[model samples]
Target: MANPNVKIWFFGGVNEIGGTKILIEDLGYDVCVFLDFGKSFSVEKQYYSYPNIPRSLDELIRINATPDASKMPVLQGLYTQSEITKLSQQKLLELEKSNQFKEEQESNIDAIVISHAHSDHYQYISLINRNIPIHISECGYNILKIRKWIERPSLTNNLFLLNVHTFKTGQSIHVGSLKIEPVHVDHSIPASYGFIIHTSGGTVVYTGDFRFHGHNPFLTYQFHDKILENEPIDVLLTEATHVTKSILSNEDEIGRKLQQAISATERLVIADFSDTDFDRFRSYYNTAKELGRSLVVTLRQSLILGALNICEGLATPNILKDETIKILIPKREDPTKPVTGERLSSWQKIYYQHLGAEVKGSVQSEDLWMPFKEMLAKMGTPPEEKLISHAQMLNKSREYVLCPSFNTIGDLQQVKPAAGSVYILSTSEPFDEEREIQFEKLLNWLELYGIPMLHVHVSGHVHP
Candidate 1:
């Protein structure tokens, strides 16, 4: 039997989207360091502002609210990950009672080095307390700061303890016995990192969720260079997101293909995508403009435009200020029930307001949305089509905002759009193997709605 402290276990996010927990133990030093603590999602775990709000792909996971015995099918063997997520969830609920979470972290962990700011990567880290300092990239730190601004400020008070240490792309930082080197690599998002961990025994290069589409060869070269520069690495913890031969198209090629596909469509193309994924999202926006049609986006996505100040996001001034561009906000009046949430603004509010579409129902203006309830709130059944028409929906389909890829299963917004027609998927390869399978699930849904062209998209991540 190997020593307990010498083992390295990937508790979550091995092949799935969430519950990414990795533990490294060194019995010789009586130490164990937790790599990442992220939770996965299930359609059942989705949160809704109102039942009517459309569902998103992120909503598909069973949010780990508590550490429990239940196991994720993909992550069944990783018992340690499951327990941690469950416990983390429980602690979050009781977080109101005490500041003990900070003190409890030292139980086994020496440090946490975050790779990026994707929900699966850093949301769980946000769950950790003030005392534990986290090592991260500069971009990751900016993203976390923005995330705090986006999520509730009160619930995550100690989040300021999110001591984010920004390391350069090639810089290496040492923590006790663990020496970690951060390498800048291309993922769908910029500043995403793949780390090389050096320990007494050997080294391991963990690819924290990456895609090598067009500039991928750069990673291969870097990999070989690192091997030559350092001693031999014992393990290469890589993400098999597109391990299959299917991930062949590079970002440019996929973008071109998506362009061709969009060209084939007549009406304004409305796509539902993660606003955070500015590259692909902006690509679509650019494509729409290139075709001489106005590409309409929602306030949520357009919000990304001003955030360029945060870092290297994809929103451009011309594109951000486009006239044909329309932004969606909650109806000024309670088009439905009342709403409640604070508004986020510094420049985006003015930016969106200038573009002419800031009704309500967004990360910002959520609180103002409450007045919309009384102002534009639908008292009984929705108003006649004429009244709804006043809301400025798509005119024959040219406008597009990339949205969730799946159906509500049984949630709100009864229109459902049958599945396929409403959501515009990119031609990019599936995010990971599990994502490939999950994409199949969404495809099945599109089959229900008979939404044509399910795989009509491109990848923002690069490859060599």
Candidate 2:
């Protein structure tokens, strides 16, 4: 009898809403690959809550974040040598006695193909051994790279740093005995992809988180046609995020709601959504333009857009060239007092460097610390006849759409939305108990400000 040609294993993202880790073994060729090594979104609730996380990676593994396969002998080759060594001290002693502990270490995992850049889908990627090669779309790679900058402490580290090799949509990638073809799928984030793997056992399809009702529904349909063309698929691993089937609004519906809310309001309009959701960004951006209002974003969002613009394929709003989009540069602070440029943190310096790098190659502290208006002037942006300062926004209350992230909510106090103003919650509702706590605080702030709220959002995940 012939030996089994392939073996499949599930490590995470099972019976849960993220942290999916699937291992496929090409036994015929003695190689294996992972579809996604994501961290669960509820990691804070399940294991470590904020301000109480373990100090070291060792502690992190003992509590949570460690895959169950760490102890299984069959998966010894799948994890990195360093990881295995940390998990098995007794085994390390045994290896030392055998005079094999000093042997060179390497990763057994052949490749890691990320579906998207969402934290639940790819955040835990930093946990994988850096030696293993990573494959993602060009846009996804650029997004991650941009995130690695501007963000304090950086998103990636040695344990899970990506040796990224980007591929275009529908490009075929060969890894040992298996062939992977990435199919572009429209999701909340740019560059989301589903995979069609050709295995010796049978053809397998894994639909990464995707939705057809987004701005680009054609891409999802294209994916459908491609998968159907494969004829007989032996296995299909699909994401059922909205399986319960709630009455959900598509992007178009959400846009209409936004338009009505903006038209009805007589004061400042502030819209809150995921910074990475380019579709929602576009929706608000277009609405702002139609209303002769500018879309105001913080430096981080502008940096994100700038990165997207530089990336080859992803469709992003032109924050730099477009007069309709204005930036609010964050001020360096010292105990609530604004500080001088010389006192900026390392990360802030990186932000200035990124902004300057976008304009040209030079990175001057003066250029870094310039006011948003001054920076725009340096970038050759026309003088802001309309969108300029917080005071200006206050004077012309209904002339702009302010996009503030949760962390930047304090800015709302400064802007002070007027009585008839509306706060459009264009993001997700808090479904988790822990997240509900945060949402409650946000509601408290809205109530205090007396701003009417409107929930106009579309889910990025398709219904079951």
Q: What Cα-based lDDT does every candidate model obtain? A: 0.49, 0.69
Give per-residue lDDT, candidate 1, residue 446: 56
Instruction: TM-score for candidate 1, please give it.
Output: 0.63
**Candidate 1 local lDDT, 1-464, one digit each (tens):** 13333568665666555556676665555545556655444322344233333232222233433232234322222222212233332233344234343443332355677776666665556445444567877656655544443333332122434446678666787777677887766666656777787766677677776665543447545755676687676777666544553545665665676677677665434365555565565566667667765555444444443343345433253334345454444444332432222453423343333433333444333343232222122111121211111134443444443333223222113334432344455545454455577567766765676566535543533323
User: Please, what is the TM-score per model?
Assistant: 0.63, 0.83
Cα TM-score of candidate 2: 0.83
All predictions: root-mean-square deviation over Cα?
9.8, 7.4
What candidate 2 gets wrong by more than 4 Å, as runs, is: 1-3, 77-104, 154-161, 312-316, 331-339, 350-388
Worst 10 residues of 1 by lDDT: 379-388
Q: Which portions of model 1 show Cα errors greater than 4 Å?
A: 1-6, 15-17, 27-31, 42-107, 152-161, 214-224, 304-309, 312-326, 332-423, 427-451, 458-464
Error of 2 at 282 (Å): 0.6
